[model samples]
Target: EDKVVQSPLSLVVHEGDTVTLNCSYEVTNFRSLLWYKQEKKAPTFLFMLTSSGIEKKSGRLSSILDKKELSSILNITATQTGDSAIYLCAVAAQGGSEKLVFGKGTKLTVNP
Candidate 1:
């Protein structure tokens, strides 16, 4: 079965601090890896990585994929209390249709 594992299950940081979250996966017929940030409600899309060595960035958030290693990393710069959330990593596999297998997620708490 396809599965994803995220490191440092939880994190605590002060406002303005930077954080890095790691995700590794083992799956067949892999299509892509996606990152999402979840706060009080549903998760919000962060990035989608299909090709290795390519970094996707949006403001203070960025992510990169390493296909050779079957892994990905999410980096958050200048985190604020508003940055506190659960970061989820999911892998899409090619089947009849694309299906996503999600990681447990890394919970980040940015303190003021």
Candidate 2:
């Protein structure tokens, strides 16, 4: 079975602080790894990593994949209270039906 694990299940930070979240996975014929941020309801897509060592960035958020290690990392800079949310990591495997297997997620709380 494919599995994803996220480190530091939860974190507390003040406004303007930077945070790093880690995710590792094990799956057969891995296709990609995706990151999502969840707030009130559904999760919002963050990044999708397929090739190793290429970092994907959007504003203060960025992510990179390490295929050799079967892992990925998400970095958030200058985090604000508005950035408080659950960060989810999912992996897509190459198979008949494309499905994403998600991790429990890392809960981040950015205080004012």
Candidate 3:
């Protein structure tokens, strides 16, 4: 199960101030999360967060950089579990605007 939560759904701010609105979640089969910033016309994509790692997976849906091919994939893996934790994303969009979407999946298979 996976869910995205935006704390303090509402807030008040002043000019020349720095604020951090938080979005937290707990996912069993966590894969990817996208952040959107909407002003008026349809919302635009801000960024994508995957359980895999930024954009560094390769081979089996892993992200890797090929200096020769001059290309890369966002499905690579090489990390530590202790260094694992969901990234907290926050954005300030128009009132009653913006949303947090949840997604999951990858090329990881665990077998005995």
Candidate 4:
């Protein structure tokens, strides 16, 4: 079985504050680690980390993968009200029907 878990299921941060989202997993034949930001309809891709040490970054959001530890972290800097969303983490499996198995996600609220 492949599974993913996220910590601090929810968070409240003030505008301009920084936050870190945590995700840990136990997976079989893990292929990659993916991060998504969800506000309404569906999750939007944030980062996909496959190799260790290298980080994926976009503006105020960044993430890194740790294959050896079977974990990953996402950081949001200078958060704004518009940054409020659910952060999801998933692991990609090799040769699996469900390409990715996801965590319940961490809900973030940035107060302006």
Model 1 vs truth, CA RMSD: 0.8
For 1-112, candidate 4 gives per-residue lDDT tens digits of 7889998899999999999999999987888999999999889998898998798889999998888888999999999999999999989988747688999999999998
Model 2 scores a C-alpha lDDT of 0.97
Off-target runs (Cα >4 Å) in candidate 1 are: none
Q: Which residue ranges in model 4 land beyond 4 Å of their true spot? A: none
Candidate 3 — which residues are off by over 4 angstroms? 51-112
Q: Which tens-of-lDDT digit does each residue in 1-112 have in candidate 3?
A: 3355554343333333323334555544334455443333444554554433345322322232232322223321333222122223322223343444432211122221
What is candidate 1's lDDT per residue for 1-112, written digit by digit as tens? 8899998899999999999999999998899999999999999999999999999999999999999999999999999999999999999998787689999999999999
What's the best-to-worst order under TM-score?
A: 2, 1, 4, 3
How far residue 87's Cα lies from its native spot in candidate 3, in Å, is 15
Looking at model 2, the pairs that clash are none
* lDDT (10s digit) by residue, model 2, range 1-112: 9999998899999999999999999999999999999999999999999999999999999999999999999999999999999999999999887899999999999999
TM-score result, candidate 1: 0.97
* Candidate 3 TM-score, true structure as reference: 0.42
TM-score of 2: 0.98
lDDT of each: 0.96, 0.97, 0.35, 0.91
Runs in model 2 lying further than 4 Å from the true structure: none
Question: Which candidate, 1 or 4, has the higher lDDT?
Answer: 1
Give model 4's TM-score versus the native structure. 0.96
